[model samples]
Target: MLIYANRDAVEAWSREEAPDNVDVLIRRASAMVGVATRMARYEVTPAGLPADDDQADAMRDAVCAQVTVWDKAGIDPTAVETEGRVSKTSMDGASFEYDRAAELSERTRVASTLCEESYDLLRLAGLIGGRPWQR
Candidate 1:
């Protein structure tokens, strides 16, 4: 398997570590690879682990940044669970509720932007479309 990103890169980017959360980091990194590969229409094989180094770096950075934010928020990005909701009522009786499942956090949005930028870069590089199964 081609690990385009590593613990060192993530640590360097986030400047924090749990020493015990390596598995979680690995899961997030793997997810980044899966999504990036799918977007690039490529298969992640030993021979072609990193179809493009720049794309891989961008994807890894995005995932790592998101993972870091999640860690700071005490949430597991890979966990399949509800983030719950918060409701607030104004003095005038107006009420509002924020839906966690339906909304993205600012940090999360930033991470998504990074990933999108990475995809865009790859697309411009002509590395964005080649389905392995098409062969």
Candidate 2:
């Protein structure tokens, strides 16, 4: 008593879903790198690690690469407070970087989960009679 739909429909759906999942993953990775960058900067400002300007620049460069990936994926880079500076705000008399590390971590996890789910969906659709690759 089961009715089967067209194979093309399922294949189309899987293809449509995969890009969205990949986009989410890319965005999450970008945000995580951004937060990590801000944290590194904060640590440097307070004389925490690296203890030198050159090392800090290197860390910034790594973060910038992540930002580039986000840009390519059509995700908005974190907003800058100044033309060439990260946003910093004073809250409760304490300076807080706009980069929310905890939130970024959570988002990255969610994006990863989505990616796994999307992959499983694709596999299932293929097993359930999706289209074959043309090449």
Top model number, TM-score: 1
Per-residue alpha-carbon lDDT of candidate 2 for residues 22-122, written as tens digits (9 for 90 to 100): 43333444344333333233333443433455543333333333333333444433321222334688978999766566555544443332233232333
| Candidate 1's TM-score | 0.50
> Looking at model 2, which ten-residue stretch has the lowest summed lDDT?
126-135
What tens digits encode model 1's per-residue C-alpha lDDT throughout 1-135? Answer: 344556777688778764457556556655654555564554344665555666566556655655565556555555434455576666677777666745545434433322444444445555554432231
Q: For each candidate in the order shown, give its overall lDDT on alpha carbons.
A: 0.54, 0.36
At residue 48, give the lDDT of candidate 2.
Answer: 41
Off by over 4 Å in 1: 1-3, 41-47, 83-135
TM-score of each: 0.50, 0.25
Give me the overall lDDT of model 2.
0.36
